[model samples]
Target chain A: MKFVGVTSCPTGIAHTYMAAESLEQAAKDAGHEMIVETQGSAGSDPIPQSVIDAADAVVFAHDLPVKDAARFAGKPTIDVGVKRAISDGPGLIAQAAAAAADFKANPAKAAAAAAAAPTGGLATKVDSSASLGTQVRQWLMTGVSYMIPFVAAGGILIALGFMLATFALGKDGPVLITAYDINLPKDVAHSIMDSFNPLSLTWWAALLFRVGVAAFGFLVPALSGFIAYAIADRPGLVPGFVGGAIASTTGAGFLGGLVTGILAGLVARWISRWKVAKGVRGIMPVVVTPLLSTLIVGGLFIVVLGRPIKALMDALTNGLNGLGGGSLVILGLILGAMMGFDLGGPVNKVAYTFATTGLATVGLATDAVQYKIMAAVMAAGMVAPLALALATQLRPKLFTEPEQENGKAAWLLGASFISEGAIPFAASDPARIIPASLVGSSITGALCMAFGATSPAPHGGIWVSLLFGNIFGFLIALIVGVVVMAAIVIALKSRDHSLAAANA
Target chain B: MSLISESQVILDLDYPDRHQATRALAETLVADGRCTDLDLFLSDVRKREEQMATGLPGGIGIPHARSGGITTPSLVFGRSRNGIDWGAEDGPATLIFLIAAPDGGGDAHLAILAKLARKLMRKDFRQSLSDAATAAEVVEIVEREVVNA
Candidate 1:
C-alpha cells in the first residue's frame, strides 16, 4: 500500500515533524510506503505530484485547519488530531488502508461529494470551550498579525521619505506645499492637489511622505476592525472601522481602538443572537446588525467614550514625555523584559503594541523620546535569539545536533528581529533560557534608553539601524546584550554539567 | 555485540532519587568500558536532564547524551525496586534507560535514539522490561525490542 500524509499543529514547531516521523515509521512497519509533508512554523517541504497521484489514501493530522485542503478531496481520507498520529500512527494507517478499499468499492456517492473542489472558506471550526482571556488573546493576536505588514510598509517608507527629502533638499530648501500657497518651487507642485506627480526630487519626497502617512492612517482602523472581525466575523467590520476612525479623530489612539473594536464585536454578536424571523434574519447581518451596531458604537464614542478616552490619551502622552533619566531607563527595562520573556507570546505582543502605539501618538512629530522606546523594544527583542545562536556555536558539544541546526536559522531570524526564532530553545529549557534572555534584553533596553537611541522605523531590526539617531550607541547596546546573554546561558548550562560531575 | 549487554542492566536497584540513579548509571558505563570519563559523560547527561525533564508516560525515564566522554554507544537499564523521581508530574519512574553515545559519531547515535523512542511508545515493551526478574532477562528483552528494533 502507498499513502501520503500532511501534519500540522498551531505552533507548527515540534509536533508537526514528530507526527510526520511517527507516521512514516508506522507506515513502513505496516509493510507500506509513505510520503509525508510537514506544515510547520519553519515552513513546509512540498510533496511531489506523482507521489500524491499514486497514493492509496491521504491522512491529515492537524490541530489548525489545513491550507489547500481542497486538493486532497475525492481520496479516502482520515483526519485526526496530531496527538493521535504521534501516539497511534500504526492504528491510523490501518484504518486509512481499510477506508481506501471501501472508497474503491463504493465510488459513486462517496466520490461525488468528496471529489468536488471546495470553495476556499471551508474550515472545520474547533469547538473547544476556550476561556474569555484565551478568546480575547486570540482575537488580539489576529489583529496584530494582520496589522504588522501595514506597520512595516508605512514605517519604512516614511523613514526613507525623510532620508531622501533631507538629502535632496537641505534645511534651507523651499517648502513644496505651504498651508495655503498653490505655486511651489518644483514643477510637480500642482499635482499635490490633483493626486500624484513624480517630476522633481522635492515633489517625490513629499509624495512618498504623504502616501506613507496615508497608509499609516489605516493603522488604527485596521487594528480595531480586524479585532472585531476576529470575534464576530464579517458583520462586525463596518462598525469597528468607523469606531476606530472616530477614535483617531478624537485623539483617543490605540487604546480607544481596542475598546471600540471589542464593543463593536460584542454588539454585533448580541444582535446576531436575537431570535428574529427568517426573512429578518436574512437581512440582519447586512442591514440591521451593521446599521444598529455602527450607530450605537459611533454615538457612544462621540457622546460618552470620546472625552474620557481623549483625556486618558493626553495623560499617557504627557507621562511618557515627562520621563527623564532613571524613569526612562526603567521603562525601557520593563518593555525589554516583557519582549524577551515570551518571545512572540502575549507579553511580547503587549510591549510591541505599546511601542507601535507610541509611534502613532507622535504622528509626523519628531520626538526623540518616542523613538527611544521603539529602539529599546527592537534591540531587546533581537538579543535573545542572537545570543542563543552564539552560545550554540561556542559550545557545540553542549547542544544536540538538532539544536545546532536550529542555531543556524536563528542567526538570520535574530538579525531580522524575530525573537520567536528562540522559541524552540526556550521551550526545551525554559528555566535557564528565559532568564538569560530576560537579563540580556533588560540591559539592552536600559542602555538604549539611557543613551537616547532614537529609531524612526518601529521594526526591521539591524537592517534599519542606519535610520536611528544614535546608531553607534544602538550597536554597542546590542553587542553588550549578546555578550551578556551568551555568557550567562553558557555559565548556567556548564554549571549543570559540573553538578552532574559532582553527582557522579 | 549489541548496544545493551547483561553487564549494563541493574535489576531491583536501590536508589533514593534521580541524582543517585543517574550517578549509578554513569558509573556502570565507565566500569563496563563503554565510556572514557565518568565525570564528562555524567555532566552531559545531567545537562540534557536539566534541559528536559526526561520523564515519559507509563513510568519510564530516558536520560540520554552524546558526549566526548563516551567511547562507545551504550544503553544502561536500571529497574528500581522503589521508583525514583525523574520529574514526572504523575509519579516516579521505575524503568530508566540511560543512553550514552559518542560526540563525533556518525548517524549511529541518532539511529539508536530513534529505535529506543519507537519501542518506548509500546506498552508491551515497557511491561516486558518491568516484568523481567533478572538483569540478564532485562538485557534480553531490550536486545530483542530496542537493539534490533
Candidate 2:
C-alpha cells in the first residue's frame, strides 16, 4: 500500500524532521512505500496534486494547521499530534494501512464520508449532507440546465442559416455566406447593412447565422455564471460571468468557464462569511462582496492560472505539430480523441486548428497529408453528437425530456459538422460521455486516416459531399464511430452510475 | 570559518542547571565573534526553552533559536560526563548541542541542524560523539556526520 503524510511541529525544525524521518524509517522497516512532506521552519515542500491523488491514505501529524488541508479531504486520513509520529511511527503506519484496507472494503461508506467531509469553502448548504461528488454534479447540472436554452436557440439558428444558405446559393452557399457571418470588417458590414435587403433569403441567412454566433458567445459565460449562482447564490454571478467572458476572450472555452465558475463561487461564498461592522454590513452583500469577490477571482484567473493554461495549450499544440512527422494514423487517433474529449473546448479547438492549418498549407495539392488529416478530423468531430443522439434514440429512458429533445436535434447538428452539439450532454455527464466519445472518436480517426479519405473543404460533414475525395471511406468511418460511441454511452448510462443518478 | 571549533566545545560541561551551561556555551559564541549581544540572544533561547524544554530521550539536549544578535549561524557543543538534567523524561542529558542561526538566514543552517537532529536519532552517531576524547574529535564526528558545511 502507498501512503502520503505531512509532519509539522510548533517550532517546525527538529521535531518536524524527526517525525518525518521516523515515519519514513518505520515504513521502510515495515516494507511499505511512504512519502512525507515536512512542514518545517525551512518552509514546506508542497506535495504535488498527482502524488496526493494517488496515495492510498494520508497522515497529518501537525501542531500547526495543515496548509491547503482541503486537498486531502476525500482520502482516508490519520490525524494526530506531531510527537506521536516521532514516538510511534510504526504504529501510525500500521493504522494507516488498516484504514486504507477498511476504506477499500467499504467504499459506499467511504464515499459517504468523503461527501460529508465538509469541503473547504462550501460549509453551509443543505446539499453538504450529500456526498462530495453529488454536490459537484448538482452544481454542474445547475449550470447546464440554465445554459441549455442558449444551446438550443443558438445551434438551431446556425443550422437554419446553413439550410437557408444552401437554398439561396449553389454548392458553395455555406462557404460563401459564412464569410458574412465571420471576420467581416466593421465598415464593410455597416456598408452592407446600409444596402440591406430584408426580404432576401441570402441576407436573412447571414443575419441568422450572425445572431446565432452572438448567442453562442453567451453559452460559456452563462454556464459559468449559473454555476457560481448555484454555489454562492446571487453574489457569485458577477465574478463568474466576468471570468467566463475572460475565458472566452482568452480561448480557454468551456473548461475555463467551469473552473472560473467553481472558483468564483468559492470566493463569493468565502467573502460572504466575513465579519464586518454594522455600517459596512449593509453594503457587505450588495457592494463589498461583489466588488471584492470579482476582483479576487478575476485576478486569480487572469494573472496566476491563465498563464499555466495558456502554456499548457501552447505545449499541446506544439506537441501535435511535432507529431505531424510521426505516424499519420496515430496523429488522427490523437486528434480524434481530443475532439470528443471536450467538444468545443480548448482541446477540440486545437485538433480543429491542426487540421485547418494543414488545409491552409495544402494550397492546391488535394493529395497532401493535410487533406487526409482534414477528412479524418471532420469524421472524428461528428462522432460525439451522433453517438449521443443514437444513445438517446436507443434508450430514451436513460435521458431527461430536455436531453432527449437535445438528442433529436443533435442529429442535424452532428451531420452538419457541429461538434459542439454534444456540449449539453458532455456538460451534463462528462464522466460517462467524454470517455465513451473519446474511444469511439479516436478509432474513427484512425479508420479514416487508414482509408486515406480526403476533404478539400475545411468545414462541413456530409452536407458538402461534392468536395469529399473518398466519400465511401469517410461514411464507413463515421458510421462505425457513431455506432461504437453510442453503444459505449448506452452501456455506461444504462447502469446505476453515480454521474446520472439524479437524472435516472 | 567552520560552524563549530575547539573553543566552542567543552567536554566537561557539568553545571547545576541548564541556564549556566547555556550561558557558558553562549560565551564561546560571543568569543568567536558570532554573537553581537549575549544577553539578548540568551533571553531568546530562554524564551524558547520556556515554551518547550529542548530535551530528548537517550541522553541528548538540543536548544536552538534564531536570534537578531546572531551575525552568522554557529553551533556550540558540550558534553556533561556526569549528566545534566535538561528535562528529559528518561534521565539527564550527557550530550548537548546549542544551535544558533542568523535571523531570516534559516534555510542555510537550519537544514544542517535538521540533519543533526535526525542523525542524533541514531545510536552510532551518539556513541561516536560520546566516545570522542578531544573537542576536535567531537567536531570531526559532527562535521562528518551532519554539519559538513
What TM-score does candidate 2 get on C-alpha atoms?
A: 0.45
Q: Give each prediction's root-mean-square deviation over alpha carbons.
A: 14.2, 17.3
- In the range A314-406, model 2's lDDT, one tens digit per residue, is 565455445543387888899899888888665786577557534322113445676788889889999999989999999998897768877
- Each candidate structure's TM-score, on Cα atoms with residue i matched to residue i, is 0.64, 0.45
The DockQ values of the predictions, listed in order, are 0.03, 0.28
Model 1 per-residue lDDT at B67? 78
Interface RMSD of 1: 7.0
Query: Just chain B of model 1: what TM-score?
Result: 0.92
Docking model 1 quality class: incorrect
DockQ of 1: 0.03
Best-fitting candidate, scored by DockQ = 2
Task: Please identify model 2 stretches exceeding 4 Å from their true place.
Answer: A111-504, B81-83
lDDT of 2: 0.78
Give candidate 1 regions above 4 Å deviation.
A1-24, A27-59, A62-128, A171-199, A362-367, A501-504, B1-149
